[model samples]
Target: MLERLIESLEAAPMVQRGDYHYFIHPITDGVPLLDPALLRDVACAMVTVMDLHGVDKIVTAEAMGIHIGTALSLMTDIPLNILRKRSYSLPGEIAVHQSTGYSTGQLYLNGIEKGDRVVVIDDVISTGGTLKAVLAALENAGAEIVDVCVVIQRGEPELGRAYTPLVTIDVDADGVRVIDTCR
Candidate 1:
């Protein structure tokens, strides 16, 4: 399952930015174009490895994570909660500071409550900063994170927990190469 996704990504458009070679996948960068089939492939691969039983909600960040989260939510009939970059002054909304390899900002959490069992998903894990921040917020909210999944693992950051990543990639001046597979 992951081999198919990696093949598709390797064929996708790539642009070099300094020391990093970015693969412009539709699910992450919204570039090169949107491929529903590819997205479904990714979601299917993720669902195969995830333990979805008893999970109360599926949480993810805005933009890229939305697509994967929505797919998983539909697959398991679980509710999906997106952590938005913009904060809403609604009751019970909580915000946390997040610093990714690319940018830093505040991600607002909504619809999560105490004792909720959740599975967090993301597009990529480069620095693990975003996931770290989300984990902190979820801990503060008293929610139990059952599992963490990322489509791509770009860097080896100690997230203090285990996460299932479909494809582990390494990018450099040469290009992006699949270094390992999580499945």
Candidate 2:
């Protein structure tokens, strides 16, 4: 099933490469449009796997990770929580947490509870800084992470033994490259 999805994604003319073994596809010609159908398909695929593995909730970073995390939540009928890299004036004590996103920076999450089973989601995985911090937060919050879902996975350092990654691209080396046809 994943093989077919990989073939479909590879054949799609819209898919393009980015930094850190990442790839993005424009559903429309411009404006960073996201296709609901594609998102649903990806989410369903992830849920199928998660169901087999038994995951309870979906966790992810703020901003773009929300897209994949929402779809997964819907498909799995699970709650979604986000690990925020930025504080949006959310009512809380403003605790100090650190993380590295696909880029370098500190990250945070508010309102996460203890002992929740979670699956992290993201649009892509590059350097794994963000993922590492997210896992740390989940541990701090006392959530048991089962896995991670992503649209693309670039070659970078692993996020320790926390979880496994599910992504469109499995970067085998140190750099992000657009597949032959993506260019």
- Summarize candidate 2's per-residue lDDT along 26-94 as a digit string, tens digits: 311213566566667666666665532565667777677777777677766778877666777675413
Clashing pairs in 1: none
Global fold similarity of model 1 (TM-score): 0.95
Give the range where candidate 2 is weakest over 10 consecutive residues by summed lDDT.
Answer: 174-183
What global local distance difference test value does model 2 have? 0.58
Cα lDDT of model 1 by residue, 64-107, tens digit? 99989998888789999999989898898889899977789999
Flag regions of model 2 displaced more than 4 Å.
1-23, 26-31, 51-56, 88-102, 167-183
lDDT scores for all predictions?
Answer: 0.87, 0.58
Candidate 1, residue 4: Cα displacement in angstroms equals 2.5
